[model samples]
Target: MGGLSSEENASSKSTSILLQIVEHSDGSVSRPFVPISAPSDDRPDATVLSKDVPLNPTHNTWLRIYRPSVLPLATKLPVVIYFHGGGFVVFSAASTFYHGLCEAMTGAISALVVSLEYRLAPEHRLPAAYEDAVETVLWIQSQARDPAAGEPWLVRHGDFSRCFLMGSSSGANMAYHAGLLATALELLPLQLLGLILHQPYFGGVERTPSEIRSEDDPILPLQANDTLWRLALPKGAERDHEFCNPVVAVPPELRHLPRCLVKGCEGDPLVDRQREFVRMLEREGASVVARVDQGGFHSVELLDPIRADSLFSEVRRFICNDL
Candidate 1:
């Protein structure tokens, strides 16, 4: 809803300051609005159908679903509820990048993909994203209990028993929080079988080698990372609030977490922390599979088709793997 500020107006493509959402010299705020892509059934591998469905009219939360067209009769596919990554301050579920990603995921995994569009921060802030993520799981459970309240695609063809929660970058942060909450929350027929965290965004007061070295990376820089936390986290809250620096300590609830797959990019600043997360999960005795791309940068999978195919292949394998 916000437009470009004076500083952003002057230096958009070549911004000098660390801020992605700029605060102008005159004290006005400006953040770039993401372009939304229309749902289409024209993907290359499969004719993917998609539509937007509101979760809660009051909170302005909603989801976009993507599913393959050609399916055998009486067949119900596994479900993937995805959260798009934008540092929790930018990006949209309806963005073309996410649409393409969901299309690939749906085709590769043969699953129903529900991409969530939750409230962004600087306006709504930290726990808002966390709360909405948890509410999405709860919302699905509600629909399962009452068919009249559910969406047609889910009610007709979605298999709640095989549902998986997935997200990339900061959205992965949301997925982690939600997955932790799901440990205690009751969802009858809808079981959370796994979690897929790709290029998870996490930080701490002490800088790691990747963060110290990646000063001006094209996709995500240390300053930009700090700025996103400043804008998204609770006001005056430090980055170590279990949500941001998850690897610091393993909580008891982790024992109840479903099997998890963590994807990390070698060229990403956050890769170290992602590795640390895997280590923590391991120490906690959680069932986990971790992958590190040799040379890929953060979110390159969303841009490059070959990379996307490879990444989605891994995702499909993770989701379809028998425990």
Candidate 2:
């Protein structure tokens, strides 16, 4: 809850210099650059099946599935359906860095990981992304029930009985809403475990202390966030509208839906809001685990490869423990 002071800010400035040096070092060049390839229907290991499958008729909505190689030998694993962060305006599942992260998560948790590719904004507009997310989950559930009906992807890797919803940033927003909708309609299968939100963008009526303090964050500027929310929500509606704010959107009846693992970054502007939402969830007696990392920025977990391993480790542990 403490804000970074002037002295801490100065230290961060110095750290940035060292970061630049390390980024440019020869050792960094030797690291493999992950390529963002289209989700394919292929098995990397005898027991593991990985594939890209379309979720919608338009074929615009799709997801990449990764099932662990040791699945059959191990206990029935939990499934994590993940949505990537992109400010709801940019990025795709083909992003090499994120794809690699998903690949790593599959190995880390030994669970099935589905990286959802939902529609982006300014083109698809508000609600389209959320609708796509809801449909994708439903489609995934159906596929799990009858693998034959789905593409070769699910037939090879999906285990629907242990399913959870997860996302980062705007994608996190979608996952949050999808969970709410599932609870509201009682449509979600009993296997739907919980939710994991990483630096979710939940716009509110007022700025939190972190938002005001980190208005000038190097990675995610507050103004940019304001802009993204303005474009992502329904036209002319308040940013804190029930749909935009999960804390408000979640109904009392849906309170018992599932456990949630909320991750936040100390240096991110949305940290305070994220914390506030977690507090609200806990107050409602929901099973919640909030992990706030120090000296981290928005999307830092994905942007920094050096940190990705640690981040993935924590996430994998959460998934395994909660499942």
Candidate 3:
């Protein structure tokens, strides 16, 4: 296996590894509530707050906040509104994977991180997750303005003027569209720092040469990618919805939208599509930095802490450079 070709190695490893990781977790902790750890000098301080703010009062949507601990007397830290991956159907704030990543991000960027637990599909479906994302942003803005909310980190540490939208995989798709909708509505008051898209899945198009080439990549197989997208998109709708696929849906006028840091895996099926997105963003006059890590698979950073730190280092540099 060590001497095998990249495609052969990936195909053999993807299923067994994914099954082992996802199956054993079952997403349940033994306690009803677990105390979050404080950020140390070595690790960013983080805490989880659960709130019942409604997305649609009728529909009754809410979100949980994963706020990184702030430096004492620190003012106006950057804010990262993050969405978790998991193909839009599995995983939640409870996952150790999410908790650790959010903490690391807080420490790396010195930003107040807001992780949205949006409703998933096929129960929620298509525009639902996107809508929730928009609402979450609006809610953050509202909370920031309210003095009665009394100086929470979002208001204290958050610099609404310097907000960064970030997401991994399916969450990246949501973040991309939410930014578009924000630009369209003229509701984006913050200085759009940049977008951090990690292994973004833009949906299966007519399979790019890379997709065909890496068909059996270890982390994300072709069939699994197709199945996740099918569940995420609208019933009978084309995969190229303006909300789903930024390459087609993104408008020419919105070209100067924001800076972008697109991270892709050489072994992942979505590598080509991510590269295409980076090209489109660059063409639109937006500053873009695209990095393709050799021999990496989809969300490999999340699965391995060492890799996650390397990825986070790049993200920190991007955020701090702008700050």
Number of the top candidate by lDDT?
1
Report how far off residue 70 is in candidate 2 (Å): 5.4
Which regions of candidate 3 fall more than 4 Å away from where they truly are? 1-60, 186-189
Give the per-residue lDDT digits (tens) of candidate 3, residues 1-323.
11223454435434523223221254321222223432332333224332323345655555444455436474667778888887776666445677678867676656677777787776677788888888877777776667477336566656778787899988888788777767765444456667888888785456676666544556666555555566667777766766556777568646655777888878777888898888888777887888898877777877777778877888888887742
Give the residue spans of candidate 1 off by over 4 A: 1-19, 24-28, 41-46
TM-score of 1: 0.90
Higher-ranked by TM-score: 1 or 2: 1
* Model 2 per-residue lDDT tens digits across residues 1-323: 34344454444422221122111332121112335765534545434446777788584788787776555653455778888876676667767767777877778767778888888765666688878878877777776656666655454655566678888887787788788777765443436778888888886766678776754567665555555666566778876787667676657755766878888878887887798789888888888888888877888877787667776777777766743
lDDT of each: 0.82, 0.70, 0.67
The TM-scores of all predictions, comma-separated, are 0.90, 0.80, 0.79
Indicate whether candidate 2 or candidate 3 has the larger TM-score.
Answer: 2
Clash totals in order: 0, 1, 2
lDDT of 1 by residue, 1-323 (tens): 23223343333342422345775665335777656798775555557888888887888999888888876588798889899998888878888878888977788879999999999887788889888888888877776888886778887788888899999999888888889988988788899999999998898877778776666667776667777887888888888878799876677899999999998878988888898889999998999999888888888778778888877888888887842
Decide which is better by TM-score, 1 or 3. Answer: 1
